[model samples]
Target: MGFEEDALLAESGLIIAPDPESARLTRTITGTDQTGAARDIRIVEERPLTIFLNSREIVTTMTIGDFPDYLALGFLKNQGMLRPGENVTAIDYDDELETIVVRTDQPTDFEEKLAKKTRTSGCAVGTVFGDMMEGLEGLTLPATPVRTSWLYALARTINTMPSLYLEAGAIHGTVLCREDRPLVYMEDVGRHNAVDKVAGYMVATGTDAADKILYTTGRLTSEMVIKTALMGIPVLASRSGFTAWGVEIARDVGLTLIGRMRGERFMCVSGEERLVRDADPAAVAAEDPRSRRKGSRD
Candidate 1:
């Protein structure tokens, strides 16, 4: 199936753009099963996602479309380009070129921020760590923990979620939730951009992540871990996997990390105590303790 391009939101909830002109493209075909029997394809859209800083073009990203604003803020946060307390002055979109302008309190120096580009297993983007430890301290999140058992449940349920990924297989999905129920489900070509969309949507709708759970379809990377931490979300889950630094950061900030969530099982790389595990009722009720209940990993 061909991937769909994004268009402006109309009266309806969904919109598709007109056939665009020729542009550069990139992709990688992934083998899903260990036996190489199962196959899943990935079409990477490394298109330019430009962000203008206070009306001046500062960055252009090769990413998928949804959540451009959140992607912008996430970019600024990592570069130490913006502070959490700084109110976003304005956001303007240019439909013609698909460019976004992000306005903030004061002008910033883009050169120094760009010098910290680092490569990842996924991609070589950029990163910065000035005052990161101090910044983590400023986040005041709710004491409520996202139970680990709930992590398994939520991870399973997320696969069956009503999201764009279920419709468009090419896109990576990002969701923001409170406990078990998800509120925002956004999709993009890049996992990073999907996350940014959640942040942007939450910001636009005045939703707080203090007690929320952030879920993604992509592997948990250090960039994602920090983004969720800055948003004040206590938990992060992914059906895929995680990088070493991603787990370390989550542990340092007292964050719960759940991954490889298949139906009833999940890998708890950090904050395992947060899960509330209970015996399977069907199994306990029956003679066999191994009697498993049927479930769909959403």
Candidate 2:
């Protein structure tokens, strides 16, 4: 490997990184290219995962089959079905049936909440049940000051990390980072699923989000903003662009929202006051062309 690859490998010592080589996560298929030459390419595998809270069957999500436990807990937590500090007695996953059941100590019911499902703009058609906005009524993220040096370091490290998105064309990634180090990296067909996995990991491991930053390889939408704020994460940065409501909500909740983070450039649309501009942008190395992922050009 070259010096750049070696540096990338050294920086990608995440607690949970992508497993692109997993046979269950990808499939090879033959197809013809532009020149009509035969080619075999690997594509990500999407499977239906039905999540149940107690006896109540929640929404069925299409995801890249991995980390079903985290996905389930995160989904329910984000949807307001699982409140914080709720006693989760057991979490059972039956891969053969493609189902995961989360049992809580208290009896649970969300029949009416499930009836008011709102379809989000996330890929694979993400659904939010029962007033996702209500969760933000009294929500305020910590005014955590983020250093520009940390942001630059995180962007360079995460962009060059080996991931399923670099392996397959269709995927989104969300990384949980502290300062300049990436901790858990999760990818899925939908960006929502990826974020949920990160959230689940936080909940499962009891990791605090107040001092952390979230990096995504997806657009900054309202759903993304809400989830990050609800998780109590102060900063959300993306290599892509943003939506109007996403910026508005981030500003309202004191959450730092930075987007269009490529190479030595980044735009902080919300919580700009929290950023300590300690890094000289000109001194930072430009993003390597070969490290660019899918949809980065958009």
Candidate 3:
């Protein structure tokens, strides 16, 4: 399909989408199959990306090395290192050093916060510094109504879209959607990185998240719930299951949490009141077998 046609197929217009064909993102390696036959397979590449906030080195993450700027910005933003309405003067990246530095108009320091890092369950060893719920106090997400129809449509469109996860099995995807239309699709070695990339995009583009839906291929964990709430997005859906803490946080923060979204079936653990059951499950098309990913049935 042509670019426009592909865009229309994925319902991703003008916004960022995964480029699985990019050489820098993946590499071909020789391996043996179950039959012991020699085969060549493409594997997603993970590299260290050190992020610096002004003069302090914040943290280093393992990522697929695409949209480094967005990842850097989003990481800082979600971590509360970069405050809302904070002026970002420049974002400088060094390809050779695999480091990205986000420079704000004012100098910043987070030595104490960095000292209290908590390892998360995300693949590639995700880390969250300080209290996991630091910035969520007194935070209230918009009470945006999510249509069942939009959820179904978004699932079909996003699952079938060409993505790094489908291209290489090791990756995870996080999509920012406005109702049924996906705006930005991001993928990385860690789902947190994908979330941060979308967060960064929203920060850079000045996109409002009060009405947006976050669709992810990873499990609905507390980290995911916290990040979605911090981004000001009302809805978070996934094709995977949820963690108890994740559900609890969603309930506390009043964020809609939907999981196990596949083949016209989903479970909303929190914020079910906001769901408008406008779509009939019988009328929704069954998930295509070709669209199945690693955790589609989980």
Candidate 4:
């Protein structure tokens, strides 16, 4: 189905831009099945993207190779290296070298910050510096209410979209939504990478965060909670479960965390004060049967 412009604008009041298409998102490979049958399968392509801030090498991430520029910007943003409204002069990417260098007008020194790297629970290996949560204390999210009707519509639209996760088996999806409409959707090998891509996209487009919702296919971990909170997004929903630390941080930060969200069913572990039960539970249909994936039952 086409992304109706007026409906999206009315529902979310945001620019529903199309995800940049990439030719290298997937590749076909011949593989043998358990029955010894040779079949061609389309597999997602992952490449190492090493990010450099000016002259210093920052971090390397494995991603689906689509939107490397956004991935680089978002990675630095979430890592607390790139501050909000930081002036970026140039972002140079070398496909052959598998590296991206972000240049800014101001000098960036993170010798002490990088020294305190801590591993996170996100898949494909996630890391956070000691001061990553330093600015979260000052973050203030708007008291926007989330409607049950919006939740149902948002899930249905995201599930119907053609995504790398649905095409290939091993991928995670993160979507930026405004109530019932999804504005930007991104997928990557790691859930953190996907969220970073979305963060970068929002920064690039100057999207407002006050009334936005963040959706993910991965579980809610502390990293996920922190990243969403850093983005200044109040509402975060996941089709998967949540970790103990994730809920703790969400509660501490007052982020509206919703997990195990399948169709009409959802568990709001925190920030239930922001949920508006606008839709009648009986009127909402069960999750689309075709939308069921590996973690749909979770």
Candidate 5:
């Protein structure tokens, strides 16, 4: 069925979940490289999307022009606009207007929330309310283990996969993994958007998070750490470094935080008790050249 038909069904009762394939928009553009060489290259298309909740305008975000419905839902979910178990009536996306309207059963009043917005360090510049951390104290993630073998395998698998980041440069990726297998891989200009899409996908599908690991190419910033904890996911891994605040929160909430992961090496900054050193570091092979990301050099 078409999106309009599916949207109607969603308004009736069903929620439209995000599929991994829905988040890709590619275009070819001519650019000049070093040595004054002109080349035609495919790039990820980006566009601004203004989202409205019911009749009130919420926020505007630059997205990769894919999965508007899921991106909208996920953005709201992470921003603390939509509460858990809140009935999402319908999500309508208009391509021509570049807008998405999400209808919910509960009424939303965000005048105060919008007034207290703060810009984050996310690549696309993520914003959150001053009181966004209000409910984080009550969230305690499950006690999940990060097996050495699983970590090695997951990183290699994700690195080798054909993704939007590999397809076009200048993008970040987030993956939801179970042990050695990556189930959902999302990429966007902003790391927050990528992770939010994964969050929205989880909410729509009712996926359990207790045993899952959240991986990202973005830094382990406070926002990333808090979002993963809110999703009830216990483990967070990244190929980047961590902020001090990010480390403190993870340590306090007992979220296993792993960073600087390249090749066969990684550092778990917090929740060290959850890591099982089952695989020998010497036995692990070097990172596959094809699996390296543009942003991993740091």
Candidate 6:
């Protein structure tokens, strides 16, 4: 399936349990209302998704259903677990077991790789520490210069992206792109999982890191930031916001952190140099209507 299709699949996560307090709510006509005919009920569902690396179960995440294969692959890539050319061969769902199995041919040294200490991360990536930070710090990203205008446009298009969010308004989404075009859009109960699916899709299709961009609907936590940096996407955009750590890591790694992208406004908190800044001296005057601003961050 394609991006929207994959996202739809991921959004179908299982509802594992119901809270007695919450389950008690129901919509019913009430005399207090003007029309006295409106009521609403709410319930939450959780699905168990297992990501397998070369048949070895690497991780399990609770997410709303849909893109199992992409979620698995994206998770691995961002976790610094996936390497180049480790194509995922198959994705199978055992309905009876209610778990997804992802198959890949990538070679791994799990015992050795997992030796590092772990730190708390947001979402299903509960804990991640780059024990291999030395090697990871050397990740070479291609010089894919994206303008601030393109960032603004991508953020704009992402708002209107077709997915369960637009259809159901109950899922998180992640989009993978090449310059102006959106290549993949994955959605799940969790934003991390959605991005993971995109990572998996990129690996399966041999998409290069230097040629892609990542977009999400969730806040730019450290995990999300690290994932985008690892994927070599110089810029990561989100509709939500970012944490202090997220901004810090992006600054250190030379990645751009763009958040609060909605309507016609956004904040470029870090890596402003990568963005296409206004060059017109007269426009600068219009921007400040005061002192002449410096042309560069000198």
TM-scores for every candidate against the unseen true structure: 0.70, 0.94, 0.94, 0.90, 0.90, 0.71
Q: RMSD, model 1, all Cα superposed?
A: 8.0
lDDT of 1 by residue, 38-108 (tens): 77554545557788878566667776554466677666654456765777788776756979888888776
Q: CA shift at 20, candidate 3, in angstroms?
A: 1.3
Better by lDDT, candidate 2 or 1: 2
Candidate 5 yields a Cα-based lDDT of 0.82
| Deviating ranges (above 4 Å) for candidate 5 | 1-24
1-298 in candidate 3: lDDT tens per residue? 3324434544446557668798989999999999999999999998999999988899889888988988999999999998766799888999999999999987786778888989998777789998999988998888999999999999998888888778878888999998888888999989999999999887877777888999999999999999999999999999999999999999999999999999879999999999999999999888879778656868
- Cα deviation at 58, candidate 1, in Å, is 2.5
- Predictions in order: lDDT: 0.61, 0.87, 0.88, 0.82, 0.82, 0.61
Residue 72 lDDT, candidate 5, scale 0-100: 83
lDDT of 2 by residue, 1-298 (tens): 2223423442465357558888799999999999999999999999999999999888789999898988998998888888756888889999999999999987887788888988998877788998869689978889999999999999888888888888876999899888988878889999999999988877766777888999998989999999999999999999999999999999999999998888899999999999999999999998898888644675
Give the clashing residue pairs of candidate 5, or none: none
Per-residue alpha-carbon lDDT of model 4 for 205-269, expressed as tens digits?
56688889999999998889999999889999989999999998898888999988787788999
| Model 5, span 1-298: residue lDDT tens | 5545643543353433323233347677899999889999877778899999989898889988767776888888888888877888898889999999999999888888879988888777898875757668766777888898999898887787777677677888888887877777778889999898888777766677898898899999999998888888999999999999999999888899999988889999998988999999999889867669755786
How close is each model in CA RMSD to the real structure? 8.0, 5.0, 3.5, 3.8, 4.6, 9.4
Which 10 consecutive residues of model 5 have the lowest summed lDDT?
14-23
Best by lDDT: 3
Clashes by residue pair, model 1: 67-197, 148-274, 148-275, 149-275, 156-298, 158-298, 159-298, 160-298
